[model samples]
Target: MSTVFDIEQKQDSAERLLAVADKEPRYILFADEFNKVARKTVESAIHNIELDFSWSKFKNQKQYNVNGIKQVHLLRMQMKESWILDAADEVWLLIDRYKPKRTIGTSGKLKSSGFKHAIYPDPDNPKRPSEILITGKDMILDFGQAFYFKYFSDDAHTAIGYGNKNLYQNRSWVYLRFRLKVRKGDKTYYSNSKGVIEMLVKNDYPIGKTLDYKLV
Candidate 1:
């Protein structure tokens, strides 16, 4: 589970929550109900879950207010789930669907050290030969923050600059992206930290989804 709220993503949808408060007064009730439900869901999930460090451990993390409530529920966001807190009289889902764009042919070398921090060697693929994952420089900047990757690679990086040659010299890095498409009236960008947007995994893909892709 993520320790922090994706400020970028939260900020994107925050304006929506704020702007309609005055006009749609019931929206406040909707938000409060949503928060209450989220808090209960998270509290129950935390109580049942057996993690080394429990989510309840963050109870006193200088976060909750005197009323003993988080400004925004963490568990729902951490679980990548979003509920429609308030719907207009004529509610219409501005459902924005996105899928990963498999990008290949881009190339970069692995970091000399500390790659282990980002590269999570999959224990399930124990017998598979390890490949040094060469990704774009900033591609993994948010590895530990947003999502944990299951790297099938190892610490052995190839020397591709000038002298030594390795079979990986010809290999390129592969990553995924959501093909960008801004809605007609969407002024706020879709991000986790700032927007009130929901980022979720696409489960209905034709190819089988990997088990490791499950989030908390």
Candidate 2:
């Protein structure tokens, strides 16, 4: 007998939840089996997702009140499965869809000895790696209160210089451009933060339909 939780794989959709009724003994299954399938689904979605940036329009406002503490509901985003909340590793925001015209490869290596913070490994810990890797995709720069892409640099321990040092700081928003995943109780919902503009993810090539959003 298959419960409401027993899911069946299909050719085109992942939302087809199977709930079969039969008289049989119930036995626990291996946890790894579910994890493998979930990871594969997420990985495929990430690689095949069509980021539609055409709908996004950048507007300039001088006296803007940036509130970093408001939660907005996503009109079209949905979380069909509950297991994904615990299985997903990191939620990354794809800042750059395409590579920059000019790049000096990956960013400089950050030595643990150079920094005094606990985030960096200490010399006393033999098991810890000596340097923390900061790739080009991992870096983002803030300009005039707004976050901007930091191009890769060949310089040691530095990103390619942009504008003046005073105007550029390494800072990022908690959530930017939709792709919000929130959890409340057993169910998880996807939405963008308030005061943030929407950037919908359209499953055009690999999957069908679009995960669009709107402010609540």
lDDT of each: 0.24, 0.28
Candidate 2 lDDT over 84-200, as tens digits, reads 334333332322111113344576544231112122244543232222221222222121121122222221111112323212232211113323333333433333321233222
Candidate 2 ranges with C-alpha deviation above 4 Å: 1-29, 54-144, 147-216
The per-candidate count of clashes, in order, stands at: 22, 0
lDDT of 1 by residue, 99-130 (tens): 22233346553334211111125464332212
TM-score of predicted model 2?
0.23
Any idea what lDDT model 2 has? 0.28
Give candidate 1 misplaced runs (Cα > 4 Å).
Answer: 1-54, 57-84, 88-148, 151-192, 195-216
Top candidate on lDDT is 2
